[model samples]
Target: MLYFIAPFIGWFVSGIIKFIINYIRFGEEAKKRIGNGGFPSTHTTIMTTTTLLIGLAEGFLSPIFGLAVAVTYIIIIDATGLRMHVGKHAYILNRLERTNKGETTEALRESMGHTKVEILGGLILGTILAFTLNIIFKV
Candidate 1:
């Protein structure tokens, strides 16, 4: 029960912190909202936090650890690579649409994923957070 709950706690806390940071840095009037891509990646935060906790609870060198690492790697790669590319493509498409129609359409922005630096930052932050919580709770 506690094991199941830890990840949620970590994710919630990380998300709140991220949101606050975004609000502070970008200001309340910024076009972007909280959880926008800039700093620590929430995707990385939640996934890495959960996996690290699982790994630590199970065993650092166990199969679970390997699986967790693989999952984390894939997520981070997607967030930084494929997602970013798709965002850029969307921007170009949206611009083309606007130019052709001579009016701006209500289109969603697809550039919501993190950069490599942001992913790395999230990885480091998540790892530290998970490790710290594990130690503090002696879980």
Candidate 2:
């Protein structure tokens, strides 16, 4: 049960935190726009949570735990590297698509990736949440 729900918990909590942060930093306009690229990447949070939970439930030396760690590493790397570049490209394209009159004909989404700090934030949150849950439920 814990394994099944840990990722969801991590995602929901990370998303709530991201939403609150966005609201505080960008105001109501941020609320009007719903997209990714925020502090504490939910993708990282869920993967980290899954990895940690697997390490806890199955021994850290177990093959499944090793697989979980590998998957988590891949996810984190993808979020910080490739996806980040994609977001940057989207930003540039969006700017390029703007007309002389300051009206954008078509705007590309720029929230496709997570920054390093965002990934770190997710890592920390996931670690804490996983340990807490493990302690409480012994899973």
Candidate 3:
């Protein structure tokens, strides 16, 4: 296997970088919000990073690359599609709860998925990191 380090590193560093940027744009609360489903979905960063690394390490036409592509597709789909519903639902429920009763200490987690823009950001970050690593190490 290739070092497989790029994906993990990219996953984390990209998120942190975006989080910092968000903080700059929106203040401290942005730091907290950036940790989850925001622009540059962390999940997509990791998955696309892995997929690209696999493609680079193995021949793009190889079965390993194919498998990685398949898995990555599913993961990105989940991040952008299925989980978005959950986030929206959480927001709705949270609003409904607040409407019926006063504010509650507990609130649903709503950052479960990525929007198209967020996923696109992830794709870009992953592409940059994975290719940069691949070029540097030539693995």
Work out the TM-score per prediction: 0.82, 0.91, 0.89
> lDDT by residue for model 2 over 1-139, one digit each (tens)?
8889999999999888988988898898667445567888899899888889889989999999999999999998888888889999988887777735665575777888888888899999999999999998988
- Residue 21 in model 1: lDDT: 73
What's the residue-level lDDT of 18 in candidate 1? 72
lDDT of 3 by residue, 1-139 (tens): 4455766787777778778877887897785675568777777788778788888877899998898888878988898888999999999998888887565767788988888898898888888888887887887
For every candidate, C-alpha RMSD to the true structure in Å: 2.3, 1.9, 1.8
The lDDT for every candidate, in the order shown, is 0.76, 0.86, 0.81
Q: What would the TM-score be for candidate 1 when compared with the true structure? A: 0.82
Ranking by lDDT: 2, 3, 1
What would the per-residue lDDT of candidate 1 be over residues 40-117, giving only the tens digit for each residue?
A: 787787778878888888998889889988988898888888878877887888878877957767765765678777
Which has the higher lDDT value, candidate number 1 or candidate number 3?
3
Winning candidate number (TM-score):
2
> In model 2, what are the clashing residue pairs, if there are any?
none
